[model samples]
Structures are given as C-alpha cells and as structure tokens.
Target chain A: MKQFFIKNRISLSVLIAFLIFTGISFFADYQPGKAISKEYFFQFFKEMIFFLPIMFVLIGLGDVWINRDKVEKHIGKDSGLKGIILVMLLSMAQVGPLYGAFPVTYLLWKKGASVRNIFIYIGAFCTIKIPMLTFEIGFLGWKFSLLRTLVSIPAIIIIGIVMEKMVGKKDFTIKQP
Target chain B: MKLLIAFSVIAIVISFIADKRKTFSGIKSGMVMFFKLLPVIISVLIVVSIVLFLIPQEMIIKYLGEESGLTGYIFAAITGSVALIPGFIAYPMAGMLVKSGVGYSVIAVFITTLMMVGIFTLPIEIRFFGRKVSLLRNLFFFIAAILIGLFISLFYNL
Candidate 1:
C-alpha cells in the first residue's frame, strides 16, 4: 500500500491540491479566480483530449509497423543531411501540440533514430508546424514570419548538433508502456 | 482541428479492420501511454490556469509597452517561457500589442520563446526525454529566442 502511494504520489498530490484550492475558493469568496482557472484548465485539456490520443495511437501503430533498420537508415547516425531534412519536413507537416509529439519522438528513439535527428524533429515540430505558421503570418505579417523561420532553421539544427555532442554517447533506458 | 481528428479516426478504423491483433496491441500501448501522461498533463493544466488568472494579460502589455527597452525584451522572453498561452490567443494579443506600440523585436522575442520554451510542459518533457535533455533543450531554445529577436530587430532596421 505504501509502495502504491509512492507510485501514485503525483496523482494523489493533485487530488490534495484540488481539495485545498476548492476550500480556499469556497471560504475566501474566491469564485472568480476559481472560475478563471477552471476555464483555462479545461481549454488546455480540450486540446489534449482532441489531439493527444490520436497521436499516441498513431505512434503506437508506427512502433508496431515501422522497422528499426528503416528508421536508422533514414534518420540514424549515417542518415546525415537527408535525415535532417526528413525529420524537419515530417515535423513541419504534423498537426498537434509539442507535448503530443513526445510519444512520436520516443518511438523514433526506440526505432534507432539518431539523437541529432530526434532533436531536429522536435525543434521543427514546435517551430515550423504549418497551421501555427499561417496564424503567425496572419497576425505578425509575412516578413516577421518569414525571417523568424529562416533564422530558426539554423538555430534548430545547431541545437540538435550540440545536443548530440552532449548526451549522444549516453545509454538510453527504454521505458516500456 | 476537427478534420485532423476525423482523419485520425478513419486511420484508426482502417488499421483496426486490416489487423485486429495489431490494432489492439497498438491501442493498448496507446492507452498505457495515455494513462502515463495524464497526471503530468493535469498538473500542468492546473498550474497554467493559476498563472493565467494571476498574470492577467493586460499587465503584460502595460509592463512591456511602457519600457520599450532591453528590460522589456527580457521581460517578454521570460513571460513567454513561463506562460502557457496558446498561439491563437497569443497572436491576437500580439497584434493588439503592436497596435498599442510594443516594438517588433519585443513581440518577436515573446513569440519565439512562447512557442519554443515550455516551463509548464517541463514535467511531461522530463518524463519523455529525462531531466538532462529537457533542461538542455529549454535552455537552448531560450537563448535562441533572444538571439532571434535581436536578429529580427537588426534586419528590419537595415
């Protein structure tokens, strides 16, 4: 039972937090803050509910079907510039939040994708996803959108390369679902 | 977004029909991951809510708009990293800020870090990439965001 509590402490803490917050809100006449926080929480959750499940399912399918050799050849150490471009393009095209991409990234890791490519995939995923870019362009203007993109490409790649240099040699523990 | 969800459903259906065993295994794995991720997601969402209520977007413009200097840019970047505001609302708020005379570079800094850095999502990121990689990635993005803002200012001026 103690081990169970330890394992589930994060969840239990959340429950505790929820009760305390509710008590404060109720006793202190803090209804507006509670209301606002609840609204924001649900909005975030709405995105996760709609998007994350599909991402996980798709990643699972990819895991089951995708061959390790193929992923390595395409995005592994020897994959080089071609690998970088592939990862970048794939990330750009995907439709989901950054957190949603984490499972896909872990799948890539399990399939022998290079550290550089994995980093590039994440960088591009957050930076260049097309729907958000269009929204960015609409609000910020084409020049702002275009210039940021041009500048970010190199920065993303550099981050990837530098990260590869840092933890590339470390053995990764493959945590199972 | 609705279309994306619909497409996912169709693909799931196709996969399920093609091979029940593979589909079940895929879904089971997905469910396992879903449960694993839920706690982290809830924690962040709750915190993001509290921050959103506390900060109140108006204070953002009031602070940065008045300064219009290095400090403002720094504040913008810091805010971007900390706040979990989505792009849709952020972009429109940014458009309003531009109208209200916040400089291009400051907005650029905010947007760059806003999209890239995720202090709110750090737990989930750590869960996936571990502590070392997650911190390194956020640090790299934070630095890159500031530089990108500077670059935009230079180019637009030139």
Candidate 2:
C-alpha cells in the first residue's frame, strides 16, 4: 500500500489539483471558454466518463493478454526489419492522451521492447495512427492528412534508426539474461 | 440519447466483466485509476484554454503566414509546439490559417510535430523514459518536423 502510494504520488497530486481547480471554477465567477460552448463542455465530460470503463477494460486485458517474452523477442534487433515494422504498427494502434501512453510504454519496457523501438513506437503513436489520420482528413481535408501521413512515415522510420544507433543499448527485453 | 445510453451500457458491461475477471485490480480499482488521470486531462484542457485566450489568430498568421516563407514555417512549427492545443482546436486553427493564406504544408508540419513532440512534457517524459532516451527521441522528432513540413508542401503541389 505504501509503495503503491509512493509510485502514484504524481497522479494523486494532479488529481488533487484538478479537484481544487474544479471546485474553484464551480464557486468562483469563472468565465466560460469562448469557442467551447456550455453544451460542448458537458458533452465532453460525459464522453470522458463514458469512455473510462472501456479504457479500464482494455488496460486490464492488456495486463493478462500481452505475452511479455514473445513481444520482446519479436521486436529485438535480432528480429530485424520485419520486427521493426511490427513494433511500429502495434505502437501506432495504441490510443489515448500522451500521458495515457506511459503505462503501456512501461509495460513494453518490462516486456522487453527495445527502448529505441519504444521511442519509435511513441513517435508513431503520435503521428501514424489510422484513426487520428482519418480524423485529420475528415476535419482538415485529404490533401492535408495525406501529406502529414507521408511525412510521418519516413520521419518515424528515421527516428527509429537514429535512436537505435545512438542509444547503444536495447531496452529491457526477455532476451536479456 | 439512445446512442449515448447504449455507449454507457457497453462501458458498464465491459467494466463489470473486467471486475469479474479480477484483472488489473478489477473494475472498481480501474475506475479509481481512470479518475486519477482526470487531473492531467483537466490540466491539458486548461492549458488549451490559456493558449486560445492569450494568442490571437492574426498573430499566428503573421508569423506562420504563407508570405513568411521558410522562416515562417520554422516559426509556425515552434509556435504550434509551444501552443499545446489539442488537434480538435489545432486543425481548425490551421484551417483559419489556410483561409488566411497560410501554407497547407506549414500547418501540416506544425500539427504533426505539435502532437508528436513535446516541448512542454519534457520533464515528465524524462522522468518516465530517462534523459538520454527522452532527449534523443524529442530531438529526432524536432528535426523530422522540418522535413515533415517540407514533404507535405511538395506532395500537395505534386
């Protein structure tokens, strides 16, 4: 219990801060956001609350479903280009806010995914996801989305290669003694 | 309303099943975990609001406007990185830029790098991933950001 509390201190601080801010916003004469409507605010909160369960389920399943050793073996340097591509694709499929990504990245580290590949995964998670791309296209236009996607692919690849060399060590993998 | 209810039901069911399975500390613990993230989520929202409130759209155009050329793009990418708006806000802002004659390519690069690279999240990232890994990753993304913009520009023209 103590260790768990220690590990989660930052998250707890953020939660406290959020509660205080929310309390102030409710009590004080806080001006609402301009572009965001009151209706939109409620709706966004509603969606977030609604999505929490799904997120929990996914996280829970990942804890059990993911094969730690196989995940590492496949993504290790010895796994070569195909492994890299697989790692990239899997990372791209991950969803949620940047912070939401950390738990999974930590899991991958525990599981033996290379730190370099994890960097690439994080980059791809940011840039190369299909849903994000589809949304970008829907909102901004196909030309903008396509251009962004094209650029991201090579950039993620390059980032992966460069980081792989510079880091001088793969992340904690099952292959490690 | 029905769709909303349906989604809620699905979420509840999933949560129940997760609990039943006793996985990852079950549904109640998961809910607690989810609530724990609320502060980070709220902080992100507050920061987005701050950017919108402080920075005028016109100023963004002047610096990141099409007429500004290569320098404009670099400025735009940096601005986008620092502004820290969500994609929902950023893309529309990019649209306004386009209507105001900002290059599509610049907006593309700005949004891409803005979402991917974290100038603001550096401390947190360092804590999570260690310094060298975080530094190398962020630096690589920053450089790739330039090429991303340039490539988008060419691709659209082609």
**Which regions of candidate 1 fall more than 4 Å away from where they truly are?**
A1-5, A23-29, A173-177
In model 1, what is the error at residue B33, expressed in angstroms?
A: 0.6
| CA error at residue B1 for candidate 1, angstroms | 1.7
RMSD of 2: 5.2
Query: Compared with the true structure, what per-residue lDDT tens digits does model 2 show for residues B68-129?
Result: 67887778777766665555666677777778777777887688777877765554465556
Off by over 4 Å in 2: A1-53, A168-177, B1-45, B56-62, B156-158
Give the TM-score of chain B in candidate 2.
0.71
Give Cα distance to truth, residue A113, candidate 2, Å.
1.7
Which TM-score value belongs to model 2?
0.74
How well docked is model 2, in DockQ terms? Answer: 0.34
The collision pairs in model 1 are none
Q: Give the per-residue lDDT of model 2 (tens digit) for A1-177.
A: 575457557656755665566567666746554333233334445545555456554555555556878877898556677777887788666555565565556556666677567766788788877656776777678867766777687778778777767774645221100
